[model samples]
Target: MSEPEAKRIKMADGTKAPVIGTHNGHFHADEALAVYLLRLLPQYANSSLIRTRDAEVLKTCDIVCDVGGVHDHDAKRYDHHQREFNAVFPGSATKLSSAGLVWMHYGKDIIASVTGLATSDANNDLLYNKLYADFIEAFDANDNGIPIYDPAALRSAGIEKRFSDKGFSMAGVVNRFNYAATEPRNAAKASVSADAPAAPKQKTQEEEDTRFQKASHFVGEQFVAELLDKAGSWLPAREVVKQAFADRAQYDAQGRIIVIPWKPEGVPWMEHLYNLEEENGAKGAVLYALFAESGEPDSKWRIRAVSLEPGSFENRKGLPEAWRGVRDEELSKVSGIPGAIFVHASGFIGGNASFDGALQMAKQSVDM
Candidate 1:
């Protein structure tokens, strides 16, 4: 016989909402995040969530996730517990969980929606890949119990043990909602409940449901906040950085250093520079970035070293060694540049009291 078709729930407002079902009792980050991503899409924005393990209830859900016995995307069933099931994204070695599965299918559309970018926009792919590498992959690896490295290999390499403690991760945070003893051990001992038929358990299924609801909300809030930041703040800064890079020749004759004008706040510009570099095949062309201090007086400008890669501290070219740790008049005398403020001891950044002096410092450092 053919399987029974799933049903949709009708809201009080007379609008129909798809029912999303997951297992009850205990929840995890994977399902929490998966549900959040699903709800972000227009099709599921007003969907109702049903938390239960009953086969009848699950069968009535328009879509089942994390708790379903099968993993069939076309059927709208997403679960990874089956013995023969092992699915990984293209070009990835780690197996996917419910969260990853959801992402693998709808990630591009979700990112475009969240970032307010058209699905055809070039940066959508960039942001999607970056987020997966930095955030979603961890959820997939954690859910599948995949270690960063093989424990036996590490042991053979003289690493005694692996640190499995990850108490701050999203998964770790969701696990906190699991049941714990309501009464203190000392209090329970004092009560002595052996004769009283286990003192009718105070915590109920209602409470578990409440906690699951709260956790799902929390995960959804975090997901929205992160994507908003990437879309609103991080992505827009790319154009500003690109324009500054294109105008590098106006700032310096060699076009080796890009100067960014003052802004009220700092922006993430380095990644954009790297992306531009990769596009132009001009890797290592620009060695330094000079920009005005965000909130500082007009006299102040900051010069920063350009790193070989995003987030890496190692710079393509550091400031002159002689200028390291020097300040004020001494720095001016050593570098032979007027308005020299200070150069950091580590040589990653330096300051000047004037824009010309900052540009001069950058040029001189490049020559050195």
Candidate 2:
């Protein structure tokens, strides 16, 4: 018999769907935030640090819907001094944790993410019990607990794509890109290079390799620009995209810019992937962890279920079957996003399947 169909859950949206087990199926940041915050929504209305705006936040959400995250004081404003929580819990020291989260909300979907402090190197870098217990206790605190949270200064994390609302793509080095267009806020300044003639070209293998390396670097920079533009703080769009690829810092430093496709490194696949050990020529679990460009933790994220829209598959014959459900089994189970908001991501998987050769083998398995 076909595998038991996904259990559908009823929602106010009028679409009856199966309720995905938060345990069996990973609930990243958005889903985590939604579940956690929804449970706490009834309390935000009475918080002291929360102004009328914070209270409005509770009223605006789906009561039982996803608001992205609690750490996202920038997106869904929270009551900072609510007695228990970090007061500045969502923002404050979370620094890169917040920026990383911003990138996820825009470029990714299928899963969501949330940031947490990992005090123990054990428990595989994900102590769910530790994180959950900490959040709930702090969130429920009453007096000296909330030491510093300013309502006027905070919004949920996934609100904007940047530190500020207005944002733009950035590229420090580019040729095709025009820099002369935007008026430089500062006076014109130019640097001079030594007046030496460039060396003549030789078709040496090393030279060819250097040229290829430069090209790859340029491409990577361009991708970063797109990531910032689409997922910047200004976008205020939920969802996150991350990259998971060969750890070769020399080649792919950003990992793989994947939509939610797999687990973070330490959970299970870290041993094989991190060590690059192909024991007996057998591949290890495919671990894909794409991060936000900003410093914050990834919020909403998921692994894109690559598939054709029914009959559309016949017309788009060239579309790889692997692109749809290729090697997603491992990933589908645990997309790293924690809270509720959702977005789609792809480049991350494409990178890994290309480098690690897992996706390619998976495709072959399906075709056979």
**TM-score of every model versus the real structure:** 0.83, 0.16
Clashes of each: 0, 90
Model 2 lDDT per residue over 1-368, tens place:
00122323344576543211111111122222223222222222121110012333344332222222343434442222222333222332431222122222221211112222232323212222223222322322211223236544566543433463212211112221221222242432333234643344343433332332343244334433433433332122211111222332322233222222333321222222322324323232232333222223433232222222322322211223324333344433333212212222332222232222333322322233
lDDT minimum window of 10 residues, candidate 1: 1-10
lDDT of 2: 0.28
Cα lDDT computed for each candidate against the true fold: 0.81, 0.28
Across 279-348, the per-residue lDDT of candidate 1 in tens digits comes to: 9888878988988876656658989999878779889999999999999999999999999999999899
* Model 2 segments more than 4 A misplaced: 1-121, 124-129, 132-134, 143-148, 151-368
Which pairs clash inside model 1? none
How high a TM-score does candidate 2 get?
Answer: 0.16
Number of colliding residue pairs in model 2: 90
| Top of the candidates by TM-score | 1
